[model samples]
Target: MEAFFKALLGEKAFLLDNNSKMIAPTMEGKKLHNLERLLLHVHVIVEEAEGRYIMNQAMVHQLNVLRKEMYRGCFIVDNLKRQGTESNNYKGHDVSNSFILSKFNPVKRLFLSDVDIHRETDLQQVIDNLSNIMEDVNGIVVFLNNYPPLYRQPYSMHLFIEKCMFRCQMEMGRIMAFLMQKEDQGCVGVLPIVGPTFVGKSTLVANVCNDARVRNYFFQTILITAHDINSENISTLKDGAVILHQNNALDQNNERLLAIIELSGDIDVVAWNSLLSSSSYLGRVSKMIITSRSDKITKFGTTQALVLTFLPLEAYWYFFKISVFGSIDSNDHPELQSIAMEIARGLNGSFVGANVTFSFLKDNLVAQYWRRYLSSFREATQRNVSLFRESPYGLVCDCKPITQLIRGDDEFAVWGRYHACPVEENVPMITMKDVIFGRGNYEGEFDVLAWKSHIPPYNSYIVKCVIEKSK
Candidate 1:
């Protein structure tokens, strides 16, 4: 907001007229001049607060008020300038014509006196009032700085009796390999974990970070939270701080560092650019683990990103059961176990959904209650899945099996060749739309030939082809 007001004032280049000035030079245009000076001070305060990452509500409120006032001041100044310009253009033309123009644009003449305080005494009074507000602002800044930092409550996953990280070993290994790769030395190796929210990108990263190989490999491991990435944040970063150009010999073992940058969907492009630019100054090897819902954003400067996959049926059941029963067998709670399995299947590979659902059932462990949950599970899951589908949270609720090319209503208009692999195959008879779109209601009872391919060179394109036997 402060930045906005500063830019506006800079662009307008407001000045005072000598003819409109007071009789004496000392008393001339004092109020408007003081307003300009006060606005600059307001900009500086806001900028400083932002630089220091001050998020106090009181500070924000004060700054917002100042910004709005400055905005109004700028608007008034701008309107006056425009009116002056129009007045000059009509010079020697006609006084009646100018009056007509002012009538047409009533804003030019209307309420001018409301904010017009250019007199020496009036300006001095306003400036004194504004200057007093500056003392309040300074006090707010000091109060905010003295306030204690608030730490986020730790997630329940760490406290869970049984961590449900089943079937993620392969994913952990894949990401671990990327981090420990011998290639891409001297440059920061970026490994982006792109998935939907609550799909366990952070969990996967956490598991991999704790891996024996990864632990030994990186000398310094820093975790950056979801803060706006700017030059100041990067320069003042304490954890995972990479000492680049200068001798990074802090200890005898001068090993490279790894910085894990975790953020939700809202990405600041300018701040990220600044952070990346600062990395060039570092001398030693470094790696960045970036997590984002947008695959395009995460994989911006990387060869490939690890897209997280949900667990298979058996794996999901095991994961969910542990969260609910804590190493107890399904046979022990046979009455609710069947319904629990059904619930797990309906979860559609969402670890978040599974955890939340099972957590609900954990305390209310009754067959009748479980049955009631099972009955409405599909509808509830459907709504949840649909909501996530519209936004790129992660993969869909259910995996589109790799066996067949699922088509939608408007898919195929003509005979086209799709490379599932290098092999050529014929897909005939059915309209592409029917095959793709018609699969919505049809549950998979049997396997069909399906091929998944990534386009070469950049490997950015995903092509899936499903061939069903012609009836």
Candidate 2:
């Protein structure tokens, strides 16, 4: 969705650039400045609209329509500028930068060269078309700034952190606190780790799972990755490294079991239901941990949803150094370290790039060669499309809205998609309406009504969120 708006803005920028060269001098300086100002306004509006586009399809359609109208206006201006000029001078120059995407690939040709703009006269038609196109663009800018809409944004990251995993220390502590907390006996707990793909959900969970405390707290643990949740796959899950207790809890020696389910957005509700309903799993006194990109899947967490966040730059620097140089501290290689940091800045928060790029560049220890690679990488970022699109970092970075959710100001949705689940006849159907938000008289202070599920004698479960209110 962001890309859709970006491409739109890019075309508009390209057209505005063309007009600046061709028409700037033809009109008054003030008029040219106004055009430039309008162009800048549109760019800002579209960039702001990126997050809003996720939930509103109609907004996208309107923007696309406005984009076409702008393009048609550009086409007319190009034609008008070409009138009576030599064929060679204006043959393809007008369309040169207009059609070429930053990555050097040509986007689909959406507009035709031949357009019929009916007018009372030739001179009048050109002026009218240009005026109308500008008016349409202005109208679009106003519409976007005034009325913002939202739609769902999709997300799709690497590295091994030998030391502190960025800002995950607190997150690890939180999960551990929940898992190790002394609570109702025989009650099962669920922790869902949700974030965009390759944003280190698995790594964070793996770190937590392998924690000495977690291992000691649970008697047995199962780590299940995506697409490996079928009965056949899950039965085989425990066949390898699992340590199952042979006795029941009544023996006073039975141990608790932990199952960690790693998932992506593609998993369906049916698969989730099947996984949750597994007789061997979801038992009293057992706990489940889930990791996925979809917010919807967090509904199964039972506790508050754990939304993974991007590492702070300082933390990411240490992570990158460890991921690449292994214990060879950056201080040892001053020059190389400087260039590495420069390149790392472009990686945003993607651990995927830190690991993969290091692997690719690991062969060359030459300082000069590393500098050259950094230079090219930086240039590509400016001149071309995202080079890391195939890599986890690029995939996540390309989807800016998800990046915003993880690291931006937007609040991540911890709960939604409530419907009735088949339970005993006595259990009432739970609907979204049952879940309510309590008002806050003070700023950032709020409360919510959540459902609680018990186990046996208590037969209810209470879902919670980890939001910190300003109050």
lDDT of each: 0.49, 0.48
List model 1 lDDT by residue over 97-152, tens digit each: 43334434332232234333543454455566567677776565555456443224
List where candidate 1 sits over 4 angstroms from the true fold: 1-161, 183-185, 231-233, 238-253, 266-273, 280-285, 312-314, 322-326, 331-334, 362-365, 372-471
Instruction: Compute each candidate's TM-score over C-alphas.
Output: 0.41, 0.43
Q: What is the C-alpha lDDT profile of model 2 across 413-448, one tens digit per residue?
A: 122112121234244333212321122222232222
By lDDT, the best candidate is 1
Candidate 2 regions off by >4 Å?
Answer: 1-166, 183-186, 226-253, 266-274, 280-285, 321-335, 360-365, 379-392, 396-471
Clashes per candidate (backbone, < 3 Å): 11, 17
